[model samples]
Target: MDKSFKIYVVVFLLLILGYLYLESTKKQPINWFPSYAENHKIPYGTYVLRNELKTFLPNVTIDEIKIPPYIYLEDSTRTGTYFFADEAINFGDAEFFRLMEFVKRGNDVFISTHGIQIDTLNFKTKRLVTGNLDEKVFFKFYNKAFKSKEFTFNRAFINQVFTKIDTLNTTVLGITGYVNANNERTNEGVNFVKFNYGKGNFYFHTFPEVFTNYNILNTEYEQHTANILSYVDSTKPFLWDSYYKTGKSGISSPMHYLLSSKYLKWAYYMALIGVLFFVIFEGKRKQRSIPIRTPLKNQTLAFTRTIANMYYEQQDHKNLAEFKISYLLEFIRTKLHIPTTTIDETFYKYVALRSGNTFEDVEKLFKFCDEIHLKNQISMDELIKLNKMIEKFKNTIQYGRK
Candidate 1:
């Protein structure tokens, strides 16, 4: 019945539909470490070690330790040999002291490359053999290359010169030879020396590549390792330490470092603070609650008349026809509280009984209301008939309830 109200309904529906479409297209972010692990071939050994260390050595447990070749030797705890193919020649005073302490405790140590320099002058002293050398050459040494199958004087001289001065019982078990500079062939000494220390013994060999997994299968090295293992008490567990320095700095993956449990609580608190800041700074922006009024040239009735004029000006007969039918349906549903699913015959009978209207009158009103909606367009006369039917239907429901 009202042109202005019909326009309001169309605008409201458009706004709601637009809001829903925008919300559906919004994107959400996701964390993806589980997917990353599955794609890469990294072993889960670090996780396994962390769990086992916690279980066995509760007091001595380390939460996390970076495996090396990435830091300096002085900073590392070299409890065992650093088994790598490359040389670590930059042994500072601290590193040297640690290595000495490790060996003095009777623990065996292995070094693959031979050119480790402790001090510049001491290294030169070891390199050169000068005049005024003492008659008694006390260090034990064994160069197998120089010796014949039987015992020989040349091999014994070198062995005696290299042996530990404090431990007279120390001996060189085996050796291998190499070529010297100037195309001269000489016994460049390679030997295994064993020294007694406290309750245990220290075994040092110049050639260390023999113990690597790549060369350990060789019969000679296999026998060497087996012999060493035999001397070690099986009751004490052996440590397979592989820590070394690769001369680099900073973290590998900073995201992994940040996401670790060590920083998880701090990250959570930081996120909460960010959200709180957002709410205070952006969400609390001053909003206008008082409605602003613009001076209208026309009053409420005049504005309503203008909307009515537009409807008539457009000559939108189909829209007007549909509007009349929808308005009547909604009005009847609201006024009588009758569900849309109710049949017209049932509705007519109830209305006629309650309103004391003749059954024929109610039937005619229902018929005209249905005819206006089913037609594509309605004439001015037909519109008046539909309006009259809606008016009568509303009045009957109101009076009957009283």
Candidate 2:
């Protein structure tokens, strides 16, 4: 590599580091997912709220419970405030009845969501849009503590408007609205409401995102949530729900424990990656290439040709004939599995039966073989005749077997 190129690479890496540092220092975007679980640290997660509650209410014990409201309160132990946060609360009739009965036992319930209805507390939500393309709005608490002071939020979202209120029992906690296209400041509707159920109170707030990390980090917005939480009974233990929004209260299994921890999880992943790379590189290095195999050269035809050439060059007709006769007898003994040491009528009959050849062919082939073996110097014509008879006998036996 060139010296200038190396310098360029170093400068590029430094720029990346600078950019990452700047980004980490900057505020993150608003996460709108409803995850009330304490493990999540995103903008919408209640992790900061849960921790802050611990500091603010040191005397009270905050428990994240996942069981149903009825089952959780069945022990009749100290009754405390139940806090439920989500996008919406669509409780079934049985659950709704159970929660109502639980609240009847002098236990308070605080629910924060976009909109919900419980018994007499009917909440009708609407969205208010103004001159701006993004529907951004401002809201203020209706209580006397804030003195009707308003604070503007940073992001644009659907401004939830509470249209109906059971005025006899419900009190408006906070109000929100947006300026219309006509440049008129319009109070769209209420955003927070509280109702008296039976012996206890039910606090329902529409703007759940106010308690999120993104808004709670802001001094102005943080005070709003603190003020809202002040309404809860701090004298009793707090039951922070981690079940409704997400169906999980704690770690699911051993896999979750392994992956949730920072160092242990990273170590596990690095070990797996190391094993994969080891298998790849070590397999490549240790594996030996297979040697190429050539077929065994058949020397049967070559040996036959050599023998035939030698016999013809020496003009040894009698020797060639005797060799052929011996080869035929050996072929019958080995291939047909018969005794061929004797040459007689009994031998012919046994060979005909075992070799699957006719008796006449067997007899003729044996006679020719015996005559050739007895000859001292056979003529070329007699050797040729014996060869033809041997070949004919082999063909007859092969045909019969087939």
Candidate 3:
């Protein structure tokens, strides 16, 4: 590599570092994730709601339940208003059964989420998009005493309301709606409902976004939040759930800061690209040429032909025939695993069966070889005939003829 090219490479790397540093220093935009976590101070987080609960209902003990209900509800003596607020609440079979038993013991459970699998209550919700670009939804209560003016939420990106509820058992608490494309104010769906399970009750609210810092901070919408909390018995203890949330209960990975920040994320991507470019360019620069060499030539067939020519020139038929017979018998013993100790009752049968040749052909070949073995001298044509018979017998084995 040239010194000038090295300087250029160094300058390029410095430029990348400068770009990453500037990006990392830039101001971050607002995060709109529905964390539903009490720790988060973001718009969709429940930090404000979590704090105000202590102030709204003064002197009441509101314990945060970070564990699942199945584990928490093990103590049958513990009874209170179990409050849960999130985008969606998912409960396992064990958790659901425990909650039912807990509620049956004359305790209340208040859940505010868009979706839930509560087959015991037989309820389902529908999420809707507004007709206008600037979205809107009005939260209204069914009770006349709680109803003042309709609480309007102009920043709703989506509205989730109960499309179907067990009407026979459930009593409506509130509703949410929007203006349609026809310029008409149409009721969307049920937002809240109260159902009596056993001695206690289960209050289900579809619009959980209301229980956030954004809604609670607004004077116009704060009343709506207050009215919703009023359903719970203030005198009893409140169990605030923190387990089932879109955001994690704790930061599990150390790479969260690097991955979550926009600038740092870009820097990480550039680092990978730099590594790839380095491999491609440096490999081309330092790569050595692989030399081509000739392979070893096989001399096995040449050596065998030279030996056969020597035997033919000297007219050594008797010695040649002895060598050929010894080699064939050794091959039959080692390769075919058949004995050549004696041409006995079982020799012909075994050879025919193992070599895939007919019994008659195997018997005639061996008998002819035996006669040749007794001869003192044989002619060239007799030697050629013996080689042809051996080849034909081997071909029967190769072709799998029985």
What does candidate 1's lDDT look like per residue over 1-402, in tens digits? 289877886686577557545644555343211111111211211223223332333343132223322222334343332222222335534344555565455444433333454232122112212232222211123434433231111111112113222337455554444323343334434245555544344444443333333223344334443343343333333333334323222346766556543346355545775687577657768644778898767588988898789889987666776777677667657765656566576666555554545567778976776676577776777766667766766666667422
The candidate maximizing lDDT is 3
Ranking by TM-score: 3, 2, 1
| Candidate 2 TM-score to native | 0.53
Q: Rate residue 389 of model 3 by lDDT.
A: 78
Off by over 4 Å in 1: 1-86, 102-112, 118-170, 178-188, 196-201, 217-221, 224-235, 245-402
Clashing pairs in 2: none
TM-score of each: 0.28, 0.53, 0.62
Candidate-wise lDDT, in order: 0.44, 0.74, 0.81
Please, what are the lDDT tens digits per residue for candidate 2 over residues 1-402?
699988986796687657555754576565566665666777777778878986556678788887556446546554788998876776645456767777778888888876566544565667656765544477778778877777678776556766666788788888788754574665567877887778887787777787777777888788777777878788877998876675245777998999766556656765785687578658888989999999899999999999889988999999878778888888888888878767787777667756557668788877777777677888999989998887877887777443
Q: Pull out the clashing pairs in model 1.
A: 69-244, 69-245, 69-246, 70-246, 139-161, 139-162, 139-163, 140-162, 140-163, 141-159
How many residue pairs clash in model 3?
0
Better of 1 and 2 by TM-score: 2
Per-candidate Cα RMSD to the true structure, in Å, reads 36.9, 31.9, 24.5
Off by over 4 Å in 2: 1-32, 76-78, 115-120, 129-131, 180-184, 247-402
Residue 357, candidate 2: alpha-carbon lDDT: 71
